[model samples]
Target: MRICLVASNRFAIREPFAGGLESMTATLARGLAERGHEVTLFAGPGSQVHPEVRLSPLAVVEVSAAAMADRFAPGPEWVADHHAYLALMLSLARTGAEQFDVVHNNSLHHLPVSMAPALAVPVLTTLHTPPLPLLESALALSPDASRFVAVSEWTAAAWRHVVASDVVLNGLDLAAWSPGPGGGPAVWSGRLVAEKAPHLAIDACRAAGVPLVLAGPVQDVDYVEREVVPRLGGEVTYAGHLTGAALARLLQEASVAVVTPAWDEPYGLVAAEAMACGTPVAAFARGGLAQVVSPDSGVLVPPGDVAALAAAVVRAARLDRRAVRAHAEATCGADAMVEGYLARYAELGQRVDAA
Candidate 1:
């Protein structure tokens, strides 16, 4: 099968610094390529090229420093750039669709869905963002989307009216994220943003009387400045953004993991990754966190209940690390995730062909 993958232009697809969606795209493209499918990933020029997965080089229109500085500020430039980006993605998708057996678009930004109806090939889109506007767009796009997949059941439920959605949880490469020596007391790895509740993890760790190493980039600068900064010190140590060996080491060293999201977490990738590293997770029972973390794998507490969350963290710290590792191996491993996706791809691909 010839597959064309559309990814966000925010960052290079292969850049190690690229976040979860980029990694997810890379994993699927490589996995499909290995399975004898011709896979081509359309992304920015900074994206690294893989032998198995061909890269469709696109000239990234970089937002100038001044433009970026005032991007969020009310301006005509923001609207213009947004329109340009949308146009670019649509143009790329239309051109690329002609050469592929099917199109797998990661952009839930409406344009892909808008273009899908005109394409000769079937188009499947995976929803990544939970923002209300995107949800509205997805609802509008559902009739056009051949098969819509949500990373978490929570996400699926969140937009049930917009489309018929299926659950395909986020997966990690166990070989790369396996447990290693130097495991610490506990770990909290995710964006230091309000929605992620990195501060809640800190509070939970404090209440649990455990030391935690908080990692991942500061995606929300204002939120960090207002909420996360004043609370940092002693029990909570900021390890910053970690990738590759450094990230694996951090996960391996943690005795347990904590993911306490203040909002409805669409998918708990951080929790899954921690479990992959043989570390149990203590997360809030909100959104997809409930779906991902089971009693055998980790512990879940009522959302916003700091006391309950603290207790769960303490309980997770005492869980059998081997069991945690085994659960992740069986559930969140790359093979399992890829198998699920491949099945979906095959099913949807056939549906497209039949139609």
Candidate 2:
């Protein structure tokens, strides 16, 4: 199948990925390419995705996560650049639709979703985040609502009324993350933002008397300076932003992975990654974390309950690491994700041809 993947222009789809969405996009594109499917990825400038997958650059300049985070109140230059990038993406999708069998949009922007009806090819948009006003508004205007796919059941439930969407859980490359030497400390990995709640992970690990290693891009500098930096020392160490082998090593070395999300995470990719490395997770039972972390793989505590989280961390550390790895392999591997999307693409293609 000829597939055109639309990625966000927020950052280049290269190593040291900005977030889970970028990582997932890269994994899916590569997996499909390796399976002999013709894949073209439209991403930010300088994106170094799989050599097998064709690259179609979007933005001329890469936008950092920190800058993207300030979208609500961005400078004039930032706003102009972002709008231009969006325009380019929409134009590409509009003009290039007939060239591909399917257009899979991972770009969080609404323009693609809103424009899906006019395109010649089917557009399958995977919703990575919960329903926002902007996206919900665009979805309302979308003609073919069934093209949307939510990353989790929780996310689907949140926006079912706006647009009927299939639930396809996010997945990672399980083979790349194998069981490793695990006598190390607990770990927390994600964007260093308030919603991700890295500080909460720190508090829980400290209370449990477990050393914690925090790793990810500092998405919010003020949040880190005010909340994270003060808590980092001795038992709590910051490893900065990591990706690829570095990230896999951190997860493999940990006895347990700690996930504390302030918001309702659409899907907890880090927890799945940790479990893939044969490391049990101790995650707050919020949003999709509740759906992803099974009892055999990890322990879930009430959201924001630091005491319960701490206790759960201790219990999780004792879980069978082999079981954790097996659970991840069975449920959220990259192969499974690609298969899910392919099935959806075939179905959508049939619908488009019928139309």
Candidate 3:
């Protein structure tokens, strides 16, 4: 089968990945290709090209200087990103059906969802985030334009009022995150931002009497400076942005993984990743983290409750690493995720042939 995957142009799909979305896109492209599907990925610059997966860079259009001169004009980057998606959608509208059996839209951008109906091939869009005004507006315009899949039951519920979505939890390569030597510091992984509340993780770690290592990109400089910077010292250490083996090794060495999200996370990919490494999770029971972290695998406290998180961390570390890994294998392994996607593609493939 010929498959085309549409990814975000804002960030390259290469490692150290910008986030879970990039990682998931790259993984699915390779997975489909390995399963004998002809996979073509439309990604941003510098995306890693696998042997089986073909890469097609998204066309980025430059906004005119005259357009920028308009006082009402939005930021240049926003206009540029909008243009890139518009160009991609227009291209797909022209030639997508002839080139592919189905189109998978993995971008958070509104254009793909809004313009999905124009393309001849079926579109399956995985909702990686909660409904935003822009995306909601797109959905309102063409709610039936694409099939929707949410990363968790929580995310699915978030969109239930807007549009029904199938729940498909994020999965990881468990083998790559194999159990490692533990009894080390606690681990906190993900984008270092206010929403993730790494600062709160620091406070929890301090109270838990556990040394903590924080990893991931500094997405919000102001948040980091105000909250994270002052907390960094004897109890907490910043490991900078890490990916692949470096991240896996760090998770494996940790006794527990701390996740303190101020917002309702759509899906706790980091918790799943940590559990895959046989590391128990100590996370706020918000959104999908509640679904991902089972009692046997980790401990969860109310969101922003540092005292509870601290206690939870100690209890989580006592959990058996093998059991934690077992829960991850049952719930968040790559095989299930890949198979779930393939099933959706197969349904869409049948729809295409019917058309």
By lDDT, the best candidate is 3
Model 3 spans > 4 angstroms off: none
Per-model TM-score versus the true fold: 0.88, 0.92, 0.98
Worst 10 residues of 2 by lDDT: 76-85
**Residue pair clashes in candidate 3:** none
lDDT of 3 by residue, 103-135 (tens): 888988999999999999899999988788999
How would you encode candidate 1's per-residue C-alpha lDDT over 1-355 as one tens digit per residue? 8888887655677645556787777777777887888888876557774588887755434556686677465455445435644665566556745677777877645666665666667777787766467447644755755578888888888878677777777787888888754347688877777888888887878888889888888989999888778878887788887775687788788878888888888787888888888888888888878888889878898888888988988888778878888888877777766677778778876786687
- Model 1, position 164, has a per-residue lDDT of 70
Clashing pairs counted in every model: 3, 0, 0
Tell me the lDDT of candidate 1.
Answer: 0.75
In model 2, the number of clashes is 0
Stretches > 4 Å off in candidate 2: 59-74, 77-86, 143-146
Candidate 1: where are CA atoms >4 Å away? 59-97, 181-183
Residue range 1-355, candidate 2, lDDT tens digits: 9998988766788889889999999999998999899999888777888899898755454567787778486765556446754665566556766578888989877777776766677778898988878777877786464388888999899778787788888889887888876769999998999999999999999999999999999999999999999999998999988877898998888999999999999999999889999999998988888889999999998899999999999999999998999899898888889999999999987887787
Model 3: lowest-lDDT 10 consecutive positions = 55-64
Pairs clashing within candidate 1: 139-162, 183-253, 184-253
